[model samples]
Target: MTTSTESPCWFTSSYSDHGGQCVEVATNLPGIIPVRDSKTPGGPVLNFRAEAFAAFVAGIKAP
Candidate 1:
């Protein structure tokens, strides 16, 4: 994947624990939501559509 000239502002979930099992997400880019392992900042990133990612999060919160 080609690197974007714009840098993403990554942030870990507020509920993240000290176990280092959390992931980071960057919403600075338009249309895409980038996710990466918090333990590996320089590692590969996974990109998902903004709407799709929102739906996924909602699904996770659903009972």
Candidate 2:
């Protein structure tokens, strides 16, 4: 969970163009990566390990 003193710098991918269906991710935090829906900024966030998140992104980019 993110502490009150911390705020994630969320950003959406430039490839996102699915009629408002998109996700935002914040990798500024140490060890953890926070993710949330772009459509709902105030909604609940899902946390992932930094390494795991990196792997996921890499996989998506891989052909």
Candidate 3:
């Protein structure tokens, strides 16, 4: 599948606190989930498979 080279629209989770420690996620890209440290916007981004990201979030949310 062909993926676009478009820029990611990053956003921090609503659950994120005022502390400097946080992560950002951009969901605009299809088939990919880009994550980065909120403190370092210009830093490297970790690209994760959408399905895998979903599973990770599910796991985190699980009791």
Taking the tens digit of each residue's C-alpha lDDT, what string does model 2 give over 1-63?
343337898888888875679999886788899899889999999999989998998999899
Per-candidate Cα lDDT values, in order, are: 0.88, 0.85, 0.88
Flag clash pairs in model 2: none
TM-scores for the candidates: 0.86, 0.82, 0.87
RMSD of each candidate?
A: 4.7, 4.0, 3.5
C-alpha RMSD in Å of predicted model 1 compared with the true structure: 4.7
Question: Candidate 3, residues 1-63: lDDT per residue as tens digits?
Answer: 334559888788888885979999888889999999989999999999999999999999999
lDDT (tens digit, per residue) of candidate 1 on 1-63: 233539998888888775789899988788899999989999999999989999999999999
State the TM-score for model 2. Answer: 0.82
lDDT of 3 at 44: 95
Worst 10 residues of 3 by lDDT: 1-10
Highest TM-score scorer: 3
Off by more than 4 A, model 2: 1-5
